[model samples]
Target: MDFEQGSINISDEVLKEIAFRSFLEVLELSADDKDAKKLKKNIEIERTPDDNVIVNVKTVAPYGKSLVEFGKKIMQNISENIQRMTELQVSAVNVSIIDVVEKIEPAEEEE
Candidate 1:
């Protein structure tokens, strides 16, 4: 983006942060989730010659969830959030499901 003064550039770290947060939102995981920190390391952002971004995300899908649906949700969420927040175009969102783990349910408190 450009202004009368100069152009605005967003750093890759910021873009990655945006993408990660959007990814977590779709998965309904909090930043404090046991795997959040490790999962964050799997997000990567690349810039294209056309000045658009391509996001590559690797994550473990919870068992019992449809992998296709899960990947679509993540791709849509990340693309929307990044474009909405940064006004940058997302060329593509590539999601890689690395593994599947059983869903962990929170324990209920005893009455």
Candidate 2:
């Protein structure tokens, strides 16, 4: 169950889970209708010709927030967290906003 050379292989599922968790921590994402494992198809991880890792993420962002900031934060956080946790150099973190989660508030009664 162990390799003599002490080398380890990280699977796509693991990376997806890590990326999902990192995205969730950004506070700008909607937890509803989001699944790291189930949405594995939306996440793609591959090694570039230079051997650097690239991650593609597709998720829903919370409405009313700055989409630009959201993308930047998601990419930054994902890349940093993934590299830190997995020890894999992430060349890029691509985020595709699939939907927006908006909370509609009820209007107050007029006095």
Which sections of candidate 2 miss by over 4 Å?
1-6, 27-40, 103-111
Report the alpha-carbon TM-score of model 2 versus the true structure.
Answer: 0.69
Per-residue CA lDDT of candidate 2, range 1-111, in tens? 137878787876788778877766774334454332355465678787765788887766668888889889989988998889878889999988767677411111001
Supply candidate 2's per-residue lDDT for 7: 73
**Which residue pairs clash within candidate 1?**
none
Q: Any runs in candidate 1 off by more than 4 Å, and if so which?
A: 33-35, 104-111
* Candidate 1 TM-score versus the reference: 0.86
Per-residue lDDT of model 1, residues 1-102, tens digit only: 899999999998999999988987987778776556566777899999988999999877778989999999999999999999999999999998877778
Against the hidden reference, what TM-scores do the models get?
Answer: 0.86, 0.69
State in Å the error of residue 94, model 1. 0.3
